[model samples]
Target: MIVRITSKFGAVDAVHKTPHTGVDIAITEGTTLRALGEGVVDRIYDGSANIGKGLSIKLDDGTQLIYGHMNEVKARIGEHVHAGEIIGLSGNTGNSTGPHLHLGMKATDGSWLDPTHLADKVANVNWINGPITQIWGLLREKVSEITIDGFTDYLADFIVAFPVIAVVSGGVYALVRILSKGGATWAAIGTMIYGLLIVK
Candidate 1:
């Protein structure tokens, strides 16, 4: 899913007193949030002055990821969480102008890192691949259930009238294509051809 970035790291606007420390993603209230990397929940904040109802996770590489402006926090302190695991829900809480998710990252050296730059490295879930694979499997199974004998029996009458069907279908296709050019004469001819086929 494409997420709109409401605020970018280091952007200094009227709303931000200081250079923004994190990227803000525009989201609706109660939207599910997921962990970006394998991490252990280290801190859970409740009604903090600035980051209300948020949580922080210490990643395997020692980097700390902070999620702010949440309505609910699902991960508990010291609990291990993998990438893509549900962590919380986005909300307009604590010092937020609207419903959005504030994502901040601190490097192992304690320096603030831009979350957008490292997004791909931490996001492990392939949202498109798994479901598509399952759907393809289902389609293959349905196709396999269609036996030649069963198909032949189902369309036995059509099979006997194949030559006539082919000729009529070809004529209809040609008539429609010619009609696309727009003329009363072609339309009349198409109607007559259709009527003849229906009568036959």
Candidate 2:
């Protein structure tokens, strides 16, 4: 799963029978929601007084995740969603006091399990390419913040420099390939000869 749910699961509300079944995540309405792992969409529901617009997806491992209170369901029933794929947008459509995401999980036996338990499995992004994921997230945020002029300036500089870099790199690669066919001593001799030739 994506491991991006910002809030922990809590006790189900006895009155709602909903909160008791799922965890409420504090999210802004319309925030993009993503699948935590590759899964098939099992169900989709329109907004009701309680559940609102929501979707249920069964993971490859047979665990089912329930996402509720979404503003829009982007995935369709029986569609396969890849890991980290955007499945919907969060919202307060059902019986919610505020905008948030209600998430629930079920085991293969069809019994409701605290989504938190599954979340625990992904608690440590640091262990599973977490740093790279974090870097990518940060980079996305940064790139989004760039203005059109800023992007244009960077693009111009890159366009100007690219050919020069490519030419130099290609020449170096050719030299290295030629020298490597010989040995280290020959490589050194070739480098010295090339240096003299360049100077001359």
Candidate 3:
């Protein structure tokens, strides 16, 4: 369940005099927040300041990851948390205009780093493989709502149709390849067909 990104890192808006330091992911209040990677809870602070109730984790690489504007903090200081582990709940706390999770990253040198592309770096890390996985469980619950008999029937139909689909796809590929190298006449015909099918 990917949520909408309400605000990106370095974005300047009415509320910000300088560029925003973190990415704001719009989520409903009480939405579960997860750790970005294996880290130990280093700081947990509550205040009416911009960040509101916040939590910081000291990652293995010596950098720190921060989660802010949380309605609740689940991790305690000095507690070790693995990737995707629940650390808090999203909220419109502090200076936030709406409910969202403010995720920030700090380098080992104590400089703020852009966290917008952090997902790309951790794309291979499955939430299901973590100790506190919730995504797959939620997906399972949704999938269970569908009838098994209907799903199996669709699967069977797909299995029966796969060979025909494969043969047709292979033939199309062969035709395209041949047409691509077939000098003038075939190229003209292929161009006409391509224009009709793809280029309108």
**Candidate number achieving the greatest TM-score relative to the actual structure:** 1
User: For model 1, which pairs clash?
Assistant: none
Model 3: colliding residue pairs: none
Worst 10 residues of 2 by lDDT: 191-200
As a TM-score, model 3 comes out at: 0.59
CA-lDDT, candidates in order: 0.70, 0.66, 0.68
lDDT tens digits by residue: candidate 2, 1-200? 22344444554444354346666654546667778888999999789648799999999999999988889999999999987777888778887766667888988998888876545333332234443343344344446557888777756766676565556545655677776754544544544333322220
Per-residue lDDT, model 3, residue 192, is 37
lDDT of 3 by residue, 1-200 (tens): 23346688899988767899888865556666778889899999684678999899999999998888989999999999998887877777888887667889999999999988764333223233342233333334335545888567656766676565556545655666775654544444433333222110
Instruction: Point out the higher-scoring one by lDDT: 2 or 3.
Output: 3
C-alpha lDDT (0 to 100) for residue 62 of candidate 2: 98
User: Across residues 7-123, which tens digit of lDDT does each residue of candidate 1 receive?
Assistant: 899989987889898888755566667888899999998966687789999999999999999999998999999988888877788998877778899999988899986444322
Which of 1 and 2 is the better model by lDDT? 1
Off by over 4 Å in 2: 1-19, 117-200
Tell me how far candidate 1 lies from the true structure as C-alpha RMSD in angstroms: 20.2
Q: Order of all candidates by TM-score, from best down to worst?
A: 1, 3, 2
> Who wins the lDDT comparison?
1
